[model samples]
Target: MTEHQDAQGQHAPTTPPAEPAVKSAGPSPEMLELAGRMFDAARTGDVDTLEAYIVAGLNPDLQNGKGDTFLTLAAYHDQPAVVEMLIRVGADVEKANDRGQRPLTCATFKGDAASMRLLLAAGADPDAGTPSARQTAQMFGGERVAAVLDEAR
Candidate 1:
């Protein structure tokens, strides 16, 4: 317990030295590969692969760097089953991307009536985010989509 002396020769209580900072191991190669595969599954509407990953503890609402969630990708790709599965697993129905586009809006823009219906059934807000699903349907001249949106309202 040696005393520490100040510049003025005043005795000061010694303090314990700080431990060295530990470096993070970061994501392993396997983790990186798995993440890539998961994103691919979402984009390609591979429901089984996505389901397996989710069951293995991957977040159902995992987003890419652009903030596009798995649900958003599935909806944009016109995959109603994948959208339904994601919604069933508790994915956010109103999660907006960086551009403020929701899954419902993406489905409407793509004229995917089935996906639009699925999103609406899962309680998605037709008016959520910029350029809402209703607005998108109107812009895309999807009369069926507009009718569904009206019915859901």
Candidate 2:
């Protein structure tokens, strides 16, 4: 055991007490609720709420456990305005989810021409991700999307 001098010049043992093991409690209810609201805002095209959350320090590119970012959910849900808002707030256009699906690919898969155009205009990579936005458009027979992709390049 080690000893330390006290203010009165007396020596005292410096041994510390043992600490108890602690368990993690994961995210708080408030945090989960906020996350739910954020995801809801993205899927429902609630640009006002989404923008407010982002302005209040929520990440524009915030992703869920499935690796889907706010932009990804908005694009997949055909929410062009929400996608635009996320993009304007600095969300990544080419961020791929755990499934390797980018926002452009999600828009193309859903045959949402407006969202696809929005993503493309924001510099989304047409040839990125697993199937790639171009391949998804071709698979879905989105000739309009293919045309948009061609025009973007």
TM-score of each: 0.84, 0.83
Q: Which segments of model 2 are wrong by more than 4 Å?
A: 1-24
* lDDT value, candidate 2, whole model: 0.89
lDDT of 1 by residue, 1-153 (tens): 468889999998887887669867888889878888887888798999999889889998888889999999998988888988898888999999999999999988888888888889989999888999988988884677799888887
On TM-score, the candidate that comes out on top is 1
Best by lDDT: 2
Point out the worst 10-residue segment of candidate 1 by lDDT: 15-24
lDDT of 2 by residue, 55-100 (tens): 9998888889999999999989999999888888899999999999
- Estimate the TM-score for candidate 1: 0.84
* lDDT of every model, 2 decimals: 0.87, 0.89
| Pairs clashing within candidate 1 | none
